[model samples]
Target: MARAFCSSDDEVRRVQSALDEAQAGRARTLAAFAVTVGSDGAVAGLLGLNEREVRVARRTVGKDDAHRVAEALWERSRLDRQPAPQDGTPEPDSTAYPNEAPAQPGPTPHVAGQAGEPESSPAVDAVLTGAWHTGADLTTLAAELGLDPDFLAARAQQLAAEGRLTPTPAPDHTGRHRRMVEGPPPPADETTYLHWHQPAPQSPHHQHVSWEQQPPVTWGTPVTAPQHAWDGYLSHGQYSGTTS
Candidate 1:
């Protein structure tokens, strides 16, 4: 039997052009899916192109690269439909390249305890309210509310779809990289001390008396004295009048 070839170069170019135009238009999700399907670097080997080139092609939607990818996908699909040879030779598997279709972008999936469900309660409403007022990101809000980020994101998307919440655009972090922060060392000349208060012991005579009937206790302020004052106190059993 004659081998079936893939689409012609002109046909692939026409399809790719259509896809590019659609991608630029409102069908952005479909365009992204088409380009990203079977995008696991292995497509480079199948198309006899380098991985970098394949990546560049996917990003820019280059005509040549698109044609090559489309041809590979078509061949893969054809191989999948073809049966084994009469001689009992196994057919080639086209799924060797990851061609998994992306999920259709539309209404969020129904989740337990999500909006519109019986499980939805005041807590959900409060979270949605806080999210509206603070404009916090999903991860931060999830952490603060002790909820899953994925669940929060999905719920937010659902609310946005329902016209109850406005979706905020993610911040652009292009060309921004994280760096380690080194704090300054502590001061060497400063002397620090910690003070703790000990509760007064109960007197034998007042052992039966409640705390409310006890006399008021006094607390003393800590002061730093000069070295001369300490020496005088140690020698005379009394502090000197001088203080620094």
Candidate 2:
């Protein structure tokens, strides 16, 4: 074997490859990052350039140094978009910071009935109300809030059942977002109605009860019918005799 003076380029590449693999496993996807920063164009825009100059990678596999550097910028943008505590929405995780989200990315996702039931909380209700009124994307909002989209969606259904929201919000085919809601669920009115028809009076010879026209009945309500008298006899279109 001949000895030759050579740099550690081969060893360096091997170690660098391992490092890249480890970081890639921990890092968020480019699409996820783009959502935080607005869009693929936005991630590149942070470099004082537009989409035409540098198109943000849609996937993570082929990302270059620019995408890696853009992570810090994307994280900051996400934080800036967080709902302020004073706004009544649940605050983002305090431990989350730029480029440090890998350790703690907001609160652990809640799947409504899985981790815990989706109880109606004031903070959640406020967020749902604002989203409905302002036409916000529920899935994106949930992500920003560090919540499981399904959990937030289940919460919306619970709110609707409790008469808080008018129409229930549903995810589209892709589950990327929820259908728009116009307003809080309309107030459900409770009503009680009584409907009955007295049978036509008959002469002493025949005794039979015939129901007259009854009032229109609404669905999902109780209807009552009274008893019919047997001894009553009709005379001149009126009951003429009374029974003891």
Please, what are the lDDT tens digits per residue for candidate 1 over residues 118-166?
4445687667656554544445555687766545544555554566654
lDDT of each: 0.51, 0.50
- Model 1: residue 178 alpha-carbon error in angstroms: 37
Error of 1 at 190 (Å): 77
Per-residue lDDT of candidate 2, residues 1-244 (tens digit): 1222234666678899999887664344544455456566766666554564233344543445446656776788899998677968766775666565556467977544654644556898889766654445555676698776656665655665576654333323421122113233333444322222343556644542222333222222212111011111211222222322
Off by over 4 Å in 2: 1-112, 116-120, 167-244
TM-score for each predicted model, relative to the true structure: 0.20, 0.22
Q: Cα miss at 107, model 2 (Å)?
A: 29
TM-score for candidate 1: 0.20
Measured with C-alpha atoms, the lDDT of residue 235 in candidate 1 is 46
